[model samples]
Target: SQQGEEDPQALSIQEGENATMNCSYKTSINNLQWYRQNSGRGLVHLILIRSNEREKHSGRLRVTLDTSKKSSSLLITASRAADTASYFCATAERSDTGRRALTFGSGTRLQVQP
Candidate 1:
């Protein structure tokens, strides 16, 4: 099973609408983060909410984490066509490799109509 998994595989909305995505994991983590990708290319970090942090927001995005339930959610406000991309939640486990590696969820693909 994936360390992090997102639900509602895809979503479609219009500009000015709101989009929400959810992720669930199976293990303990030091932190959880959200990322965005366009056209399946490189990802850009969006927000990071530590295990101890319950919620965080940046610009039109809001993220919430529930360590106890091992779940997280992301909300995009006033969606725009520019926000048409895949949103992912990733977490890093303590690795013996001595380098942190991210385990990404399946991801939520958002389509915003202009």
Candidate 2:
């Protein structure tokens, strides 16, 4: 698959600490998006940075993209117990016909202890 893969499948951190995850993809992509899934809850969009962009930030979330390395990183600052969730990186590929749906990575499960 042309999808990305996140390292350190799982992580544990104390509340108020920061959590960082890395993702690596195989093929070229049009855009990359980060999402968070809370237990049984649906995935929520965190940020979307195009291939042309280097880095972007939203609230306490910061994302960086390195197209040359085919990798990306996500950082959540001052995390809370509620911040515990599975984070995924998805790649949007260009299609000859139309825009294709995102291809998700294995994901990184984060646990924040209060």
Best candidate, lDDT = 2
Q: What is candidate 2's lDDT per residue for 2-78, written digit by digit as tens?
A: 46899769999999999999999987888899999998999999999998999999999999999999999999999
What is the Cα-based TM-score of model 1?
0.92
* lDDT of candidate 1 over 62-111, digit per residue (tens): 99999889999999999999999999999976456636788999999999
* Most accurate candidate by TM-score: 2
Quantify how close model 2 is to the true structure by its C-alpha RMSD in Å: 1.5
Name model 1 segments beyond 4 Å from true: 94-98
Q: Cα RMSDs of all predictions?
A: 1.8, 1.5
Task: Please give the range of 10 consecutive residues that has the lowest summed lDDT in model 2.
Answer: 93-102
lDDT of 2 at 26: 80
* lDDT value, residue 19 of candidate 2: 96
TM-score of each: 0.92, 0.94
